[model samples]
Structures are given as C-alpha cells and as structure tokens.
Target: MKTFLFRSIIGIFFGAFLAVLFTNAIVIFEGRETLDGALFIKNSIGSILCGWFSAVSPLYFEIPSLKLSQQTALHFVTLFILYFLLAFGIGWIPFTWNSFFITVLIFIVFYLIIWTCFYLYFRQQAKKLNAELTNLQR
Candidate 1:
C-alpha cells in the first residue's frame, strides 16, 4: 500500500514537471502564446497525463532485479514506435506531416528529459525506502 502511494505521488510530480517544461519551451522557442489561465491548466493536465503514461510503461515502471539491457532495448523500441506513430497520427489530423514531425521531435526530446528526471527521482526514493526497510528490519 505504501509502495503504491509512493509511486502515485511520484507519477503526479513527474507529470506536472513535464507539462510545465514543455509548455514553457514551446512559448519560448515557437513564439506561441496561450491565455495564462488556460495555458496553465492545459499544461498541468498534459504533463500529468504524459507522466502517468510514461510511468505506466514497463521502462519507467518500477520492478526489482529487472535486466538493464533488456529493459533498455525494450524502452528504445517502444519509444521509437510510439513517437513515430504519434508524429504520423498528428500529421494525419491536420494533413501537416512536416509540422507534426517537427513537433514530435521536440516532444520526444522533452519527454525523454522528463522521463529521465522522473526515473531518477523514483530511483532515489526507492533507495531511501529500501534503507528504511532495512533499518526497521534490523
């Protein structure tokens, strides 16, 4: 129960972080502007959703004694397919392949960063939890 709670909290945090980072980057680099309140809300939701999705994936999902090489390969393949499909899908939406491709590229990079940060944060938390468990056991 405690582990589940911890994971949930981590997922939420990662989601918020990802949303804000991407929204801000878009504003700065793409010269895009959105209404303050709406933008904030949208970004917050987006980040959380993406964060949750990533956390749920096997790559980011927590598991003990997982084989690093296999996990990494799996992550790479999944992400590659996901990004490609997403980009193509977005292009299909508006019939704008070039624009969608560029957007996907940007999103991919940002998502990668967010994933790394969340993963590290969860890892550290897990380490702390393990230590506490060990101490309690001792």
Candidate 2:
C-alpha cells in the first residue's frame, strides 16, 4: 500500500508535467499565449487521473491466475477506455466519429510500440538472469 501510494504520487506529478508540456507546445504552435483557467484545470485533473491509473494498471499482471496475454488485454482495454473518455472530455480531440477513429488508431499504435519496448527489455533481462544462473551452476 505504501509503495502504491508513492507510485501514485509520482504518477500524478509526472502526468501533470506531461500535460503542461503538451499544453505549452500546443499553445506555442497555435500562436496563443496560454490556456484559459478552466481548460487548464480540466486537463490537469484528467492527466493526473490518467497517470495514476497508468501507474497502477500493472497490478493486473500480479494476478497469478491470469495469463500474460489476458493481463495485457485487460490493461490495454481499460487504458483505452480511460484515455478515450478523458481525451474527449478534455477537448483534446474533436467530437466526431472521424476524429475518434483517428485518435483510437494513434492510441493503439503508441500502446503497441511502448508494450513492445517493455517486452523486449524484460525478455533481455530474463535472458541475462538465465545466463547468470547457468554460470553459477557450472
């Protein structure tokens, strides 16, 4: 519980940071000085929630009965729902079918990319541990 709380706090900060960074970039690109207070607050809150969920979503994998595939699918679906609803509510994406479809595509692409990177990294770590174990047995 303590570890979870610590991670949640970190996630909230990280999420807020990313929200500010992205908002700033958009403002600059659009030749605007700043976002309005309400929009800023909404985005901040949404980002924080998203971040918190992202950090804790890995707990799904801790279920011993769940296969890796099941864990991954569940995580992906929940995250997709959370992000899609938040993004739509925060006005990050337009309220149109086309916009929603495009956003979904983008989300899937990024999610797969990140998932693949982590998978490869952990797979490499597992291989290294196996090698070390073999060396120890020799």
TM-scores, in order shown?
Answer: 0.42, 0.88
Look at candidate 2 and give me any clashing residue pairs: none
Give candidate 1's error at residue 96 in angstroms: 8.1
1-138: candidate 1 lDDT, tens digit per residue: 566566667878998987778777988998976647864775576557546545545533345566755665576667666645543543322547677677667767886797688679989999999999999998
Candidate 1 vs. true structure, TM-score: 0.42
Estimate, for each residue in 5-97, the C-alpha lDDT of model 2 and write its tens digit.
Answer: 888998899899988898888888999876688878888899888898898787787789999999999999989888888888888899999
Off by over 4 Å in 1: 1-56, 59-66, 90-101
| Lowest-sum lDDT 10-residue window in model 2 | 32-41
For each of the candidates, the C-alpha root-mean-square deviation to the true structure, in angstroms, is 7.2, 1.9
Error of 1 at 53 (Å): 7.0
Which 10 consecutive residues of model 1 have the lowest summed lDDT? Answer: 86-95
Q: Score candidate 2 by lDDT.
A: 0.89
